[model samples]
Target: MTIRLTVNRERWWNHVVGVADEVDGLIPVVKGNGYGFGRAGLAIAASKLSPLLAVGTVHEIVGLPDEVTPVVLTPTWRPPDTTEPVLTVGSNDHIAALRGWQGRVIVKLSSGMQRYGGNIDLVAAAQRAGLRTVGVAIHPPLAGTDDDHRQQIVDHLPDIDPSLDVWVSHLFPSTYESLPDSHRYKLRLGTYLWHGDREALHLEADVIDTREVRPGDRAGYHLTEVPGAGTLVMIGAGTANGVAPLSDGRSPFHHRRQRMALLESPHMHTSMGFVPAGDPCPRPGDWVDLQRPLIHTAVDELRWI
Candidate 1:
């Protein structure tokens, strides 16, 4: 069936705002399928709002439209001839590895976050070399506030140059907002753009069919039989759609129809059926919006619409 339903990019765009204005600026986070909104789409949309925000890495930067102003998380090595990203940093031999870069860059700070930032020594070296230390990002303590860690940062940076901007905390938008001023230093926001303080939005595929049956009748790749008279509705987006389950712990289908996952079972055929708007119950050849939450999971396997 024709999956013609719109993704409601506007709905997503309209909701792409901060919950509060107390913060200084907006930095939309773009990572992992742009949180399923698609990188290019969200980047283009976010550009309409703020030019500054954070992208996870160099790969994400390439997907961004030129209009996108970026603070790439930790820019990978680039030749000096490669110039575009406004800010990003490196550690170890990162500067030499960068070959040559003209845009602004930050020395990644290894605070409580043990990810790909910098240590105090790296920051010192960057400063001595006169590399632009636009900011230092503290990516950790994500689970909760760490007052001792905050003080530790204060104590640890005693010799740090004040010209280096402090970008202490950056997590989901809510966490960024929750951080006390001492911890906020400079909050980096990601999930907050699509999911501010509000609860997550859910999508569910619908079961289009149920049938009454008995012991012998067979269905699906395994020739499984219907235990009872129940209908099988088809609901699944295959390779064509970005429905492939992700390895990341975050499950996009948390609220989606459970059957969507079942359809992927190798033993069960996942084709579905549907009718277009104002049409009769869909027969084969009818168009449908499988992307629609409720309608996606209800059709029977092999029941192509």
Candidate 2:
């Protein structure tokens, strides 16, 4: 009836627990559609390791279990409703605005990513502003080399106080092993923790309807041309579920590298794929394997088995 995300339970859980055991200080990040498992679900999953959960906003903390303490990653104007949320302040202005909040704070430093955080002066300003600075957060870029990432951390070490706890993202295993023994380093893991073993996860959407299409026939919202005679296979997934539209004339057909009919861009809750006249076409009710990540797509149900 809808897109379903199936997880190999044993494999997935083993990976999850393995990450928790392998990492010394693990702060599991459960944000952004919960990286496909949903935030609340991942929150429960991570509770076994640590009571701490990192979310994108204060709003995401509502449904989390009482045992978990949420750390809000982004700057927010709204106060947390419950769970004594830890606030992140990237700039002096942010720290100044959050002066009313008496809860623990983590000063985010500007790594090479440049998305958030401030210079060393802001960290000092945060402490001076009466904010109880408990930890320092650093989010590194994903594309950089090992040397580049290590240098990124080394560059920020002088700015960070050794007494404060350190949290990092996108850090390599080798980098974690080499950290100074003096500081308590907690790695903020999300995709790498949940989706690390890609084999453990599978995505599939049901084929709902099929129809014949002839060359030059009008179809879809914009009346996209049907290049040739084929069967149009409509699948249960669309933009509403975070399915992205085709880009740069790209389609699943290009990625699959097959000679079958082209797969068109998805609709709001449905997408059409052309199966050429000569090729075997999938009948309605069959499922189509999806290449998209669950984080980028919403589904009606999840099968954890």
TM-score, every prediction: 0.64, 0.93
In candidate 2, which residue pairs get closer than 3 Å at backbone N, Cα or C atoms, i.e. clash? Answer: none
* Predictions in order: lDDT: 0.50, 0.79
The number of the candidate with the highest TM-score is 2
Please, what are the lDDT tens digits per residue for candidate 2 over residues 1-305? Answer: 58788999999999989888888888888888988877778788888888788888877878888898889999876555442889898987788787767778898888888887888787788878887888888877998786677677777887677988888878766678687676678888888899999999988778899999888887887778887888888877777887654454444322133523445667688877787787767788887776676778787788988
Root-mean-square deviation per candidate: 7.6, 2.2
Candidate 2 structure, TM-score to reference: 0.93
For residue 229, model 2's alpha carbon misses the true position, in angstroms, by 1.6
Any runs in candidate 2 off by more than 4 Å, and if so which?
Answer: 81-83, 245-249, 253-264
The per-residue C-alpha lDDT of model 2 at residue 69 equals 84
